[model samples]
Target chain A: MGQRLIARRQSLKYLGMLAGSVAGREFLAAWLPKSEKAEPIRPTESSYTPLFFEPEEFSAVEALTELIIPTDQSPGAKQAQVARYIDFLVSAASEYNPALQHEWTDGLQLLDRLSREKYQRSFHEISAREKQMLLEEMSLPEQDSGRTHPGYKFYRLLKEMTVEGFYTSQVGLIQVLEYKGLSALSEFPGCTHPEHQS
Target chain B: MGTHAAYDVIVVGSGAAGGIAAYVLTMKGLKVLCLEAGRMLDPSRDFFTHKFPYEWPYRGEGKPGQYGKLPQGMEWKIKEWTDHLYTIPAEDPYALAPGSKFTWTRLRAVGGRTNLWGRGCDRFGPLDFKPKSLQDGWGEDWPISYEDVEPYYDRVEQLIGVSGSSEEVYNTPSGKHLLPAFNPRCGEVLIRKGAVKLGIKVTPKPLAVLSRIYDNRPPCHYCGACNWGCDVGARYSSLDVLVPKLSRQKNFELRTNAPVHTILMDRSTGKARGVTYIDTRNGLEYEAYGKAVVLAASLVESIRILMNSRDREYPSGLANSSGTMGHYLMEHVAFNSIEGFFPQLAGRPTSNDDGPGESCLYIPRYNYGEKDRKYLRGWRFDFYTGCGMGPGPGARFPGFGSAYKKKIKELYPAAVQMGGYGEGLPFYWNYVEIDPGGLRDRFEIPQVRFHTTSEYDHAFAIRDEMYGQMEEILKASGAEIFPYEKESPYPLGSVTHEAGGCRMGNDSRTSVLDEWNRCHDVKNVLVVDAGCFVSHPEKQITHTIMALAYRASHHLAEEFRRGDV
Candidate 1:
């Protein structure tokens, strides 16, 4: 699986440079190291245990995060272990920022309450289609006022945290986004594109 | 009381001004004793610039309650990664008026703010010295001219290894830079192209970072973490560049962690005897004597020392004869930034774009020579590429998952931002005074109370003009402007370019220091810091501070030769 991923990344880099995209060339320069390939370690769904959430709560958070950034052509939030990262963040927040800890607890409780009211079951047990419909309804603000639904505000927070957790993770940044920086370069490569010139 | 041996000169604060003063004075064969309030920091162990976020406990974003614990005025100074470089406000506190909001961003370390300064080493033009002459009713003109300080400016630039091409911009005077200029990235090129259409000249910014190996210091490795503290001696910090050189000289002696309480004065001759300071480690008071004293202890701190020094002859303060010890506190007021995405550079492959944080292009003050605006002085603009490292602002990117990831890559390289820094007129109302009701620090020394106010009409007018020009350039480049509300000018000291409080002029009643930066009342005492600045120009002040220190120290050496000091 690791070899296949590396091969795919190399091909994508080649195709990007051939098409004259600076982003693709940057990926090649940053990722194509001369040393042995060091594959990033990611926690499997089975191996991970929740520190902040209960088993049921963890299941709901995992389901919600995965749905928010579901696996398509590339690895998604589940592979990046965004739920576990969020659990770790919330667990640590209990000390300095108790308000942040309270926000997470209340937000999770709101999700549970909404899921039980609509489907008579927990959020993880709800059907994917039903989950999507419920999320769409939660996303919109009230008709009379500009304020959004409490559940929708929770969704926005969760989504923002999930995006941050995923993009910063090795799997997301290297494999998905292909970020290439923090290396010592002899010189910087300025813009070479003629189209960008006036 | 004087247990220590007498030295030729005693320099306070070992930052930019003090560093230059010590070097110049000692090199002239005068015995100098330098006292610093902060401990020395070893960059190799202290700097966390290259550390990855994952390696840190909270991913380099402070711990949950960490920010809440920071004191009100100090929260902006301490970033999660750079917290070690700043002083904890709870431990070292200052007072402010009830409704006033002033951000006194300070570092109590040996190198001071220079260790983590934005290395924008710009030279002040001829108009900066004579602001009253430029337009009436601004402020008093500087006693010295650009011609008087030009030679010292060139000497300091070469010693510090400034990198830039010479663009003959009138306000940003040219210098004999030591290194080649950095080439502009795609985003900067676009900015230049758009600015040309508006008849604005954008040239390479003169920075204090070395482009090539010079004077045994290595060139910048393009780490892009200049503010985090450079581990290698590539960037110019007094600790790295000046202190080590001064340490080699036999006449120079540096004492760290010795916070000066007051300047000891001789009552009979009215000359500065030396200084009495507390040992920060053991809390024991010690006095050091010298023939002459140079106050290079930053702007506010120097004024604090002077104000605290009260004798039978001068009850108010040591230099209160002019009554201008702590007045005319000025800071550069920065306006909101104009940021946008250049569509043409979208989806371009990324490379190691990590260079110094200094902008590749600098738009000098063009409002001068053609004064049609309501405001008196003008502003300058700086252009740079990249939205910075790490995960992008997820809140801006709507939606989640794979599609959002695609958008992040597309928008990453296209990021371009331009920030405006305008000149703030020095007002007498904005000043720092020792609290009359006895508010003192841990050392029992009285704390300073700041009362600062800006010219609202002039500030707002400059902001509107700058924002309008920025929008025109962004629109001309065919870039999508970010959705941001226009903001009011930042509060005083927000830019960390604080000046004045002890200004220089010909008149003794109006100014504290003379043209050569010597205190008017005391012949042997001199202030060679931002406090000597007559008018606060839009340009950065570190280069000028160092240049003035060298010029004043040279003058002091001449006086010593003639036995006038």
Candidate 2:
């Protein structure tokens, strides 16, 4: 019984270390019950047209941003319209910093190349399991600062834009995170918890 | 130019000093004309205090290339919200010397930087007046004392509507006109509890906020947007608190967009009888004459005006009889900052914790009377532990995907920030002068150039010690310390609390201004701003500037009654 408890504690420590990455999610899947993976939510068509990316490139960007901040318990990047925000940001960059626009275009093509090289499919045509694995592979160089591979650079840029676009949206800021600032109050009631007072 | 030649007094720059001079002088029934370098801001249109990130066109991140609008030497932080107050580069051009590194945060408008100030109204103690008498004897003592300025401080506080606790804190005077200070936030209480173990007293910051319905203004509703311009008259900006009432005085007149070019000197009397200024709207130069002229166009700008007013009688600069018009420049040492969070409060339910920004909690200078310290002057801390739960931390956090989002949500109410602001000894070499290269602004005025340094090792040592103590206090509260810069890496003028150019002295041979903030050389000219500050204190100086302006204007009023001018 002592030996089993020691082994369980070791596994728990490893689980905590890799819990946020793809590695621990797979580990948990083997033991814990597998949850349902719903169909990916696509943003509703509107009057908005892609200013920077082409029609097919926009679809791939939309798929990736939604994947980065997937809908689990609340609305994700799809509902936040993160892909449209990126297009707006990059398109506006065309006037002053054209290199920024080039980087986004090159980054999307690199992701497509990585998807085709590994899974024999385009980035938007990949399976959900294959997509997650590709993302996991692309993010390997991000863990090490010295590695400046093309895949790492592309993944970093896309992930950053995705985070910025999603978190600043009303759906993410107010509904998901429920930000507590930018409101009026008659009086501020500070830490009411007795244990926190010390 | 209506009644321009018949004014009793001409006050330049409608900011803290000029606003007070106009208010007090007009109350004394003197004809006062206030010349503002910038346009009159409509608070309903210009202020964006309650604006949300989603409401902003750029989502509060600022547009991609919009930062290029700020002039060289201007602060980058102003480009987002308060950029309208700062001057554009080519229009109001000022040069930085080849090796000099400074960020002069100049603001023009009826209210000046008061519209975007921290509003921490700390009064200098009795010791602050006689700094030269201290242990190391590094700087000169002010000709005026705390006793001489105490009554004026009281009046200014009452007039501006300050709110803070009346505490018997050392080396600090308890305010006589302060309203009730706000209740301590949770982070403040926790930090105070932690500081108790270290023998440091964390007190509620005395702020220029109306805590109650005082002087017909409604109380502050705690929006935590003080830096973004207070639209409601709850927070004290000179525009909201002083300008409206002063304008109602029949003896007063205000001219906006009228940037003063120089002090029009009377060669025979050797006194300033009028001012030459340019009206920005019509692009015309006009002369407005008065019995007396008050140079309250901020500290550096006042020096620029006096320097530009040079003639054959006093070629060095207009009141350069003592040769110290723009010498001892000092800014508060403020690069020592530590961001941390209490572990016990992590994952807790978030609340609207941003009660009063910048005026939350302060660890007052604890080394008031200590002689055994390694540093000459002491430092203080400004800590704000608001629940700034936003996308900002998520961007800074490592990783992405569902887990990253979950972590950000969990650590929502756990962020805290503490920074130390301390005194930097005035080195004689640090100064501001007219650019010898002869670059001029759009109005054909010689541009002011700055020369200063921040590589003061002794001052930086104190900044490092401040960071260490902050870590100790937070660790005592079971808080986790985030990574931060240990060394003092900020430039000299990062604080923008520049003081000391025309030093006030009892003697005329060593200083430009007399004890009453009047020019020792020119009898009718008064430099009534921080330009006459003898030494820079660790605390901010806007409160002191207002008080000194009040004292000087009252003394000028008495002289007017006596027919001395």
| Highest-scoring model, DockQ | 2
- What lDDT is reached at residue B106 by model 1? 74
Candidate 2 per-residue C-alpha lDDT over A13-112 given as tens digits, one digit per residue, 9 for 90 to 100: 2212223445434433432222323334454455668988888788878877877787778788888888898888888876656787898889888888
At residue A195, candidate 2 shows an lDDT of 62
Deviation (Å) of B412 in candidate 2:
1.3
Clashes of 2: 0
lDDT of 1 at A51: 87
Q: How many clashes show up per model?
A: 8, 0
Judge candidate 1 at residue B513 and give its lDDT: 92
lDDT of 1 by residue, A173-196 (tens): 666666555557677656666866
Q: Which stretches of candidate 2 lie over 4 Å from their true place?
A: A1-47, A116-122, A138-148, B1-5, B69-76, B88-91, B369-374, B392-395
Candidate 1 lDDT, tens digit per residue, B1-565? 7544489999998888998898899999999999999899898888887775556666565675665555332443466667877766556777878766576777878888888888888899988888888655567889998999999999898778899888788767979655898766777788888888889888888889888899999988777777678888789999999888988988999999998989888877888989999898988888999989999999899999988997777677788788888888888867546555677766777544456556667788887654567776888887656534544322244344445555666666666666778888787788898887678977787888888765468888878888887788788766766545577777787777889989998899999998888888887889999999888888988999999999999999988888887
